[model samples]
Target: MSEQALTLKQSGIRWLWLAVVIFVADIAIKFVVMENMGYGWSNRIEVLPFFNLLYVHNYGAAFSFLSDQSGWQRWFFTAIAFAVTGMLSYWMSKLPAKEKWNNIAYAMIIGGAVGNVFDRVVHGFVVDYLDFYWGTYHWPAFNLADTTICIGAAMIIIDSFRSEKKSD
Candidate 1:
């Protein structure tokens, strides 16, 4: 194998640790929200021109997409979650060494994906909260895991652009 790849394998502690941290934190927060908030409990608080805190539970994917599916979807989504978690974990492990930011980004994505997967396995669905709205328009409710996934994906994209620039 290449020297850089070997180095990455040896320096993977930080990546693994970051994933553990994000995963633990996500679990703790979700537990608190679930235990305290109660199912479907929501409170509205306008913080911006178009924002509100509306607690919500999600039974399916983004925007309540496929939320009304029959019982079969649970196992299907569980399988999907397992596949995604494995792929992301492998990707995180193979990240090049010294790419701290890149590793962090990967760790965040993997952690968040696994966090939601845990929920899917145990509860058969992900629990989403934090609602935003603008008059009659509303964004889908999401949670910390979702936020981390989005931000990590953004960082990955930004880093890809930065790498291409450097290569050029």
Candidate 2:
């Protein structure tokens, strides 16, 4: 292999490492919440009136949307998660060597997706535990993986708006 090719391989490894770190951290936090807090429970550590350390499990997509569907939904979302992870991995490989932020964003998304995918595969659902609310209305409960995925998606949108070139 050429010197440039070796360097590219090394760079890709670095990005994969980043993804691994996020994935581990995400699972670790979830494990703690699951083991200690229990499902559909909350330990309110009110950072603000609208925020709390609430624990809830989601059987489906964001906000428990479609979580009420028949048993088939779990496997369906898991399949989608695997597909997304594969696509994100591909994007990471072609990511520009100098665009560290962009690479990190892709890593975050891939890591988060894989993390939740594991839960779906193993438990047939996702364990979500963070809660945000306003007045009597409550936002969906989510975990680190979901937050990272959202951040990564936002960065991707911003990057696109900035007209960054997709490196081959």
Each prediction's TM-score versus the true structure: 0.81, 0.86
Instruction: Please provide, for model 2 over 25-110, each residue's C-alpha lDDT reduced to its tens digit, 9 standing for 90 to 100.
Output: 98898888777774554465567888878567789887787899987889888888889888877776776656687788888888
Worst 10 residues of 1 by lDDT: 37-46
| Top TM-score model | 2
* Candidate 2 collision pairs: none
**Top lDDT: which candidate number?**
2
For model 2 the local lDDT of residue 8 reads: 71
Sequence-dependent TM-score of model 2: 0.86
Q: Tens digit of lDDT per residue, candidate 1, span 37-56?
A: 64663454556777654456
Model 1's TM-score against the true structure: 0.81
